[model samples]
Target: MNKAVFPLLLLSFSSLFPAHGSGNETAALHRRYASAATEMHRVQVAMDAINAKLICRGCKIDVVDEIFSTDFRLKDQNSLGYDGKYSEAVYFDPPKDLNQTNAAPERALSYRGWYLAVKFDKNGELIDYYLTNIHK
Candidate 1:
């Protein structure tokens, strides 16, 4: 075969069956993970804001409003298990003790434990948000 033709044939074969360790797929996955991470950060920030507001008023009603406005659906009648409408879901821990912290003079409410979960779709859209312990 002509030298030029041989190289062209090889190129076509390689394209049909890409060799292992090729960087393309890995790069794409990396991009997806990075995008998801950025979105999770945004959700976390928003949840933090809502948490601050709830802690300030110490009103269960206000907390519920803040949660629902953020696209969260309360799972239980007690207002626990808040679920987000976006791809990500957050689970907040119940308040531990009623200890007062100097950070906020209005009211000091201690949180038992809080957690945030982020779920992403193939298109990278947020699907769910969750918050727990609002009633507890």
Candidate 2:
């Protein structure tokens, strides 16, 4: 194999397997909603939500950006100190971002691993559990 092709081949091979994929780890989150994809691939060392359990449905929003993103917001190092492989970070408000998007979960939950976009009804009670993503 040519040296140049070798590097490309390596990249392709690496891509086949996610460096950090989902795992069997189970995390109990305090947040209302959660995403399977985020949890599935959250482990610093390969982990995924294929066989894990989280707050909301263990699901993935096809159009990720529509939900939550750090695109315009600056990233911060501070954390809520919540320890878990899965998070309940919601990011989108639906009306604006969901107007035009691909097939995804009913609601958007944690985007990536940190951000959470929460929504409340008339009352001020937490009411998003299992409502963020689709249930499998």
lDDT values for all models: 0.39, 0.30
Candidate 1 residue lDDT tens string, 1-136: 5998999998888555313322443343334433544445434544544444321222232233234233433333343223522232333433354545657656555544444443323332333435443434
- For model 2, the stretches where C-alpha displacement exceeds 4 angstroms are 21-91, 94-136
Model 2 per-residue lDDT tens digits across residues 1-136 = 5988999989989545423223223222211124434442233111122222221222232112122232312223342224312223343232234334557657444323332333222222223332233322
lDDT score of residue 27 within candidate 2? 24
- Compute each candidate's TM-score over C-alphas: 0.20, 0.20
Q: Name the top lDDT candidate.
A: 1
Instruction: Tell me model 2's lDDT, rounded to 2 decimals.
Output: 0.30
Tell me how far the alpha carbon of residue 88 in candidate 1 is from the true structure, in angstroms, after superposition. 7.0
